[model samples]
Target: MSSEATIRRGVRNSRYAAIPNHVFEDSRLSMEARWLLSYLLSKPDNWTVVIGDIIKKGNCGRDKARGMIAELVKFGYAEREQQRADGKFGSSVLVIFDEPRDSHAAEIVGETSGVAFLPQTDLPATVSPSPVPPSPVKSAHSNNLDSANTDCQKEREGARAGSEESDTSVVEDRKRIERDFKAWYRTWPTSLNDSEQAARDAWAALTPEERAACIERTPTFISAVKAIKGKFTFSSVYLKGKAWEKLDDPKSEVALPTVHNPFSRAWMAGMLAILLRPPLTANMPAPTKFQLGQIAQGGDEADAVRIDRLQKYGWPRVNTMHQRAFDRQGVTVPPPLVAISEGFEQVHRDADLAKRWKRAFERRGWPWLPNTGHEWFFFPAGEPDEALAKFSEATARERGDDDAA
Candidate 1:
C-alpha cells in the first residue's frame, strides 16, 4: 500500500457540520483548533458553548480546553466583550463569528450576525410595555358636533394640566441639579476643581438617573484617589469620563476607615502606616536620578498613579513596572495576603507575635513597617539570634516563603 492513508466515505448525518474546506486547510490553525471550530459550527444557531461541556467532550483539562478557545479567539473565530449588570462589572459575553471580524466591526454582539454565548442568570424577567391600540373609528351624523366640542374641551384641559406639571418638574429638576452640583463640587479636591463650567455642562448632559449614580459613587472614587495618593482629575473630566462606573458598590467599602479630619491623629496614623510600609516588591532597587528624570518625562503621571494603587491595593492591582522590578531581582513575587477561613485564625494568632517582633525590631532602631496587606510582621536585622530565628521561621512559613523556596 501507498504511504498516504486510504480515504473512506460515510453518509452525511443531519447532525454533521457543513464546514468550509478552508477551516481545515488553513495553515494558521492547529488540528485541535480546527476540530473545536467544527464542533462549535455544528451546534444550532445561538447555541451557547459551556466550558464544562467542552471539557467533558474533549476529555481535556480546563487549561487545555480554555487554550483551544483562546486559540480560536486569537485567530478571529470568536470575540469576548466585558458586560455590566446592575451597574457593576459582570462576566464577559462571547460572540463567535463564521469569519474573522475586521478592526472596524461593531463591538456590540447584537449588532452582528454571530452566535452569542451568554451566561444564564437568575434575574427577574423584563416586562415589556403594552402596544397602543388603534384609535376608534368615528360614526357620522350621530351627535357628531357635540362629541367634537366635548373632546376639544377635554384636550384643552389635559394640555393645560400637562404643561403645568412639566414646568414644575423642570424647575424642581434644575434646582436639584444645582444643589447637588455644589455639594459634589465641594467633595472634589480643591486643587482639581478648575473646570466648574465644564463640570456643570457634563452634569447637565446626564439623565436624572445617571446624575444620581455619579453623586452616589463619587465618595468611593474619592477614597480610591486618596488611597492611591494620586492626582485628582478635574471634576468635569471625571464626570465626562463616567469613571465611577468601574467602582464596586459602596457597601463593600465599609472596611475603609472614615476620615473626619485629614490632620487628626488617627488619620495621620493610618497615613503613616501606609507611607512607612515596606516596598511592594523585595529587592527592587530605587531608580537613580537619571532614570527618575526619564520616567518623569514620558507617561510618568499615569505610571505613578498605577504604581501607587498597586502598592496600596496589593498585587491584584497589577503593575508591569513592579513585576519587572521583581523579575530583575530574581524574586518570585507572592500575591497579596488574602486571609481565608483558617488563615483568619492564623492571622489573629500572629497578632501577638507581630507585637513582640515589633518591640524587638524598634529596640534595634529599625522602623516598624507593615506589608501592604498588613497580614505579616516586619523583620529588621541585628535583633537577638534566637528571637530572630523564631520570627524568621514563623513568618517565612506564614508568608509561603519557605514553600516558594
Candidate 2:
C-alpha cells in the first residue's frame, strides 16, 4: 500500500497529519521530533507555524517547542527560510526528507507560483512629514490662573514648552509601540535577517493611529497563535500588509505563554549553564552569562532594564566570581586569558592527593618526574577522582593499622 493510503486509514480528516513511517524507524530521531516533522510536512508549502503554534499544537512550552524545532533544523532534517508573506518577510519552515519515498511526496502541499509574494523592500528614502498642526493662540486668561492651576496653563502653552512635551509624547509613544512589536516579533518560530533594524524602520513608517491599533490587537494575535488556529501577523507582516486594519475583529483569549525577554533569557541561559558532572571541577561551577546592558535605558531597552531592576530587588548584588570561589573552598587556577595572565598555566597541586597519585602514576608506567619539557603529570584541572581514590585507600590502610594496635 502507498504511504498516503496508509496514513488516511489512521486519520479520519485531511486536516490531521499522517506521520511518515521511516521517522519512527530511525532510532536516532526522538518521537517528539518525529511528530514535529510530521506536523510541518503535513502543512502546505510556504505554510508558516509560529512559536506559539508549536506550543499549542505540540502540547509543549514555548521554549521547549522552539528548542525542538531548532534541533530538527540542526540535525539536517528540516530547512527554514525567510520569504515574502504578502510582500513582507515571514518564516517558511519545511521538513527535509533527503531520501523521501515516492509515496510520501503527495502528502506535502502548496503552490510555488512566485507571483503573489514580492521581495520586501527597505524603507522608502523619504517619509512625508506629518501635517503641521495650526498654531493655537494662548489666551491671556491662562496667565491670570493661581498657583494651583499653573500646571494646566503650562500644559496648554502653544508651540512653546507644551509643544515640546507633545513632541516628547509622540517619540515616547513610538518607542512603546516598537517595544511591544519586538516582544511579539522575537517569539517567531524562526529568526530573521537584520530583524531589529528592519523592524524599527517598518515601525517608523506606521501612522500613529495604525501604531495604536496594532498595539491594541497584539494580545489577540498572541492569543490566536497560541491556540494553533489563526494566521500570525508578525511585525514585518503587519507593516507591509497594513494588518492593523484587522484589529477590529473579535478574538477569544487563550492563556499566554511566558513571554520572551532577551535579558531574562540571558539570565536563564546562565542559570541553565549550571552543569554538575564528571567533566566539571569543583572550582568551575558552571559559568553564568550576564553581560551588562547599555548604561542609557530607553526605547527597546525597557524590558531588559525592567528585568534587571526586578533582579536587583530580589537578589543582592555581589562579585559573582568571588562568591563562587569562596563557596568552593578551592584555590583558583590560572584562567586562560589573552593578557599576561594567560601565561599562568601551572596546574593546581593538591599535596596529599599528589603524593597518592605519584605511586599510581609509577605503577601505571606513566611519567611522574620526567626530563625537561616532558609531559610531567600535575593535578588535573578537570576530574581528579583517581587522586581522591588513592587518598581514600591510604587512609583506609592507616585505619586498619590503628584497629590492629
* Overall local distance difference test of candidate 2: 0.38
Q: What is the C-alpha lDDT profile of model 2 across 1-405, one tens digit per residue?
A: 111100001111133354445544444457787777766656432232334345556878756776776655665555544334477643342434422323333222112222212333644234332243111212221121121112222232221233656556545654665586687566543326436655555654454565666667666656545444455544566565665444332222222222212112211112111111012123333222332333244454544444444333322211232233234322211101111121122332445554565554433322232222323223323234553353334333222221110
| Candidate achieving the largest lDDT | 1
Candidate 1 displacement at residue 350 in angstroms? 26
Report the poorest 10 consecutive residues by lDDT, candidate 2. 1-10
Q: Which ten residues in a row have the lowest lDDT in candidate 1?
A: 1-10
> Model 1 segments beyond 4 Å from truth?
1-162, 190-193, 249-405
Alpha-carbon shift of residue 303 in model 2 (angstroms): 68
lDDT of 1 by residue, 1-405 (tens): 111111111112222466645555545667887787777776543333345445546778667877877876787767765545588654444555544564433233223433332333645234332242111222211111112112221222222223666445545656776898888888877525377777776676455567789889888778755543457778778887787774532222212323222222222222222323344554345665765766677785545543543354432212322233233322211111111111221222156665665565444333334333334322322233463554344344223221111
Residue 378 lDDT, candidate 1, scale 0-100 = 26
- What are the clashing pairs of model 2? none
lDDT of each: 0.45, 0.38
Candidate 2: where are CA atoms >4 Å away? 1-18, 82-405
